[model samples]
Target chain A: MNTATAPAGPGRGPATHDIRNQIVVAATEHFSHYGYEKTTVSDLAKAIGFSKAYVYKFFESKQAIGEAICSNCLAQLEQEIGQALEGVEQPAERMRKLFKASTEAHQRLLSQDRKLYEIAQSAAAEHWPSVLAYEDRLRALLQHLLLQGRDSGDFERKTPLDEATDAIYLVLRPYLNPLLLPHSLDHNDQAPTLLCSLVLRSLSP
Target chain B: MNTATAPAGPGRGPATHDIRNQIVVAATEHFSHYGYEKTTVSDLAKAIGFSKAYVYKFFESKQAIGEAICSNCLAQLEQEIGQALEGVEQPAERMRKLFKASTEAHQRLLSQDRKLYEIAQSAAAEHWPSVLAYEDRLRALLQHLLLQGRDSGDFERKTPLDEATDAIYLVLRPYLNPLLLPHSLDHNDQAPTLLCSLVLRSLSP
Candidate 1:
């Protein structure tokens, strides 16, 4: 298979990254649809018009590919949450923004990036170590923000930060499951706003 | 197999409903140890020293047996929650009790009825209509309580009851996952309580 054209004035720079990204996206779709047990490296390679050898050139193994894709999905989620809370001064406002950003990202995963969500959930169930590490990372970020809120006197929590973070993640659990979405969820953009408002009501000082 | 003396009856005077309670306890242990996919009617019969025919006398199928077990579990949960909220006039106080009761029930499920918890979670994911119906029933109960709190002017302005109930369910999702509790989760329990408290605090007038 041939490469999909390199970047202009660059020595095969963007194409390399683009091809890897494409492979990651294709792999995510395969894992989500067929589940991790059924998805194969060959299937992922075929989807992106690349030979097995070419796919291997980017990813050392299927596990490696999964790690890369999972990390990317999580990193993007972390960024979205951070951006949502950015520049919000009020504790309550920050809390609202935090939930809105997180839920919107979750909704996007259910719709546009359905595969990523499926992959993440399935991975967490079957692949314990990697998923646990990912969970820890996410939890740490949440813990930091919660502590910040508490220090700023925005939050009046008595519980430890880790437990509080767990609470936030648990509350958002249903939103992560694709099966629980309303029939109108796809058309409804107000989900994040409504979810954020309610969550804020739950946590406001 | 022979019957287990039929609760000291005279030559078998048709085992009473209380005897049925004994069968349920035995069945719970069997299901918890063997899981839904592996446990069988014959096994349960052997465990209780009752013939398969005798076991069939009370329940129609393994599925029927499962339904009975789950119904009992939910009933116990409802009772505990009610007891926790007993004599609690204020909404916030009621919420604190509710969280404590729910956590206790959750802990019991983790330690004593793990098999049923696994079955219920899988059932929920697999779209078992009964599981969904039970969950809806729970949501309705929570909504009723929220309405009562609102009517009493104890709760502050918040989102609609149905949506808030969904948020509460989401917070409880982790304990429902068997994998998350392969070992005791006494430490993890703090998060959901804190989350519940935060939300309740937000709603306090």
Candidate 2:
């Protein structure tokens, strides 16, 4: 029942953050083996030599722990996509790189941290805030890119930007969706590139 | 272990099929509440007033019963799509109809029988033959429609038909996917038409 060593209040320091990271590391290991749903907070505490209350100080609930993991993974995916899009001037080529990079990045990320996909799948199924926030950011990024295309006169302005961004996001969603990614990576390795080409052609003025 | 009243031998007729249908109906009802993975054949037998042995006679395994239900539901979907396309001239229009019809029909069907979506999710996750077969048929349907567009000079033939079909199918997959469909129908009612227009614009000869 003791949580004296755990971080308290809003003014906690880096040591407190390390405790948070420790809990996440232990929870990830537990979730990877037993899955996110079946493992209880108590099990995680026992695995990490912390009291359940101690664990609670760091994460409000099992879902919060999952959210932390899900957020980090998505951030990594965003970084990979950013690297892929780097120095690309034209919106059309940027669009192509965006598709290919996301597909490849998602595949690599999930494949490497196979356990993380399980957490993400749960996050997606439950509409976790982390997933929603990521979706919002990605959508804004897409809308900005589409605006570039229209402004440069490289793409038609017939379709509303929101609608086009949504449609393109829909097409890319499967690659990002944990439930759908395995099939995409395993069977449809060429899909992202082909779909991007099709979308770009559709955007021609 | 008695299965005295069960139809036997290879010459089984409509009566045998009736028994099979009966099992599927009961299983669907049971699965709707308990879910597919949770319910066993014995539970189905008790619910259907049949001996477990007799139930096994009709369905060699639980998945067989599930397959029957999955196959029937997909058949209904195909029929609905077929009716949507009936008398529609022009491949692009037909394509539009195909997208709209499938999206609408899928939403209607799944919403009307909410439990059925649960079963479908399982079948899709497991890659049941029924799902694979249905995907194949739908792909063939799209390919045929695209070929018609190409022959009539409505669509550009620059992109290979296979790649176009696959890319388009990838867009539609989210709608067909049990995991993704609920979200699509609930939030993206206009996506089908918007995407179809985008794809059609891309196909301009």
Candidate 3:
């Protein structure tokens, strides 16, 4: 067995990093196709052409791999939302695009891989710190947008910033919740647009 | 044994009606003090000094009794909300009072009897038709309020009436969800008031 393929701490050579990334990619594929309950560590290792022991060297257990997948997905979502807001000077326009981008991204991801969506749901329901932290970041992003709207005179300053943030988050939950999006799509394809308009109108100057 | 005490069909004497009401009251107490899983037909029968067979005649099963309790609670809540809206001509004031009355009534009942709340949660999760019907009624009430607001020029008619109704309901979920209100109360006692103001502002002309 090649010693370079073995897992090592951070700052190790690129060989270890590559191997860890390979494991995660393979694990994600297996999880998406086979679901969490059915996908075992051995299956992930086999997909990556590594031993089960080699997989364990990097991730403590199957659950850790699932967490890593969820963390990566959330990070990617955060980045996508950030990119969507770029080049939009108006706060109202930015808010509209933000909602559109966020909802579309979530709906697209869930539709592509239902098992991955289930893992995300489980992580949220279990109150995983990583997922919780991501939620806080999302809320902060909305709060910043609301502040921008107020400063730009696009939104009236009737409600306090914090209260407005909570209100928007609560109102947009149906659009943001992946589990509910499919149902919403079936019920009304234009739900995201409708909700976005309502949210903006709520903040009208 | 008193033949009059036996369960009878509708329009049987007033005595039969009284006994049925008595059974429902006793079952509600048992289900409240003890959880749904622990409360049995025998226990209810014991509480009301009736045989288990007699209890079964009145209610097909323990679940039937729970359903009756939930139906009764929802009816009382509906009446209270109706009363709260009485003599309030201003749309904003009516909306405010409606939210306060609804939230307070739910919180009060859940605090008084947690078991009933749990049953309600189960009913929602299971998609019991009775609970679904109640939800429809609640949404209709809000829709009526929103229509009145729009007609009175208190609210701008930007979005369709149905969409606005949905937006308000989604935003107020935290206040209206029985399982969530207790936790929200623990986190912030003033959430209902804050949400109400935000909702009304969203509808302002």
What pairs collide in candidate 1? A202-B198, A202-B199
Q: Write the per-residue lDDT of candidate 3 for residues B1-205, one digit (tens) a residue.
A: 5556433444456876677788888877777777776766887788878999877766666777777777887899889989999999998998899889988988887787777677776665566667778778889989988989889899988788888888777656556665445444543567678778877777888
Candidate 2 local lDDT, residue A140:
89
- Report the interface RMSD that candidate 1 achieves against the true structure, in angstroms: 6.1
> Over the stretch A59-101, how does candidate 2's per-residue lDDT look in tens digits?
7778888888888888988988888888998999999988888
- Give the distance in Å from residue B127's predicted Cα in candidate 3 to where it truly belongs: 4.2
Q: Which has the higher lDDT value, candidate number 1 or candidate number 3?
A: 3
All candidates' chain B TM-scores are: 0.71, 0.90, 0.86
- For B43-148, candidate 1 gives per-residue lDDT tens digits of 8899889998877766667776676676766677777777787898777677667667776776677676656676665554454556556656666766677777
**C-alpha lDDT score of every prediction, in listed order:** 0.64, 0.82, 0.76
Once superposed on the true structure, which residue ranges of model 2 sit more than 4 Å away at CA?
A: A1-10, A21-34, A183-186, B1-10, B21-35, B183-186
Q: For residue B82, give model 3's deviation from the true position in Å.
A: 4.0
- Compute the lDDT of residue B138 as modeled in candidate 1: 60
Candidate 1 has a DockQ of: 0.25
Better of 2 and 3 by DockQ: 2
lDDT winner between 2 and 3, please give it. Answer: 2
Instruction: Give stretches of model 3 more than 4 Å off.
Output: A1-12, A29-56, A60-63, A79-90, A108-115, A177-191, B1-13, B29-56, B60-63, B83-90, B108-114, B126-129, B147-153, B157-159, B178-190
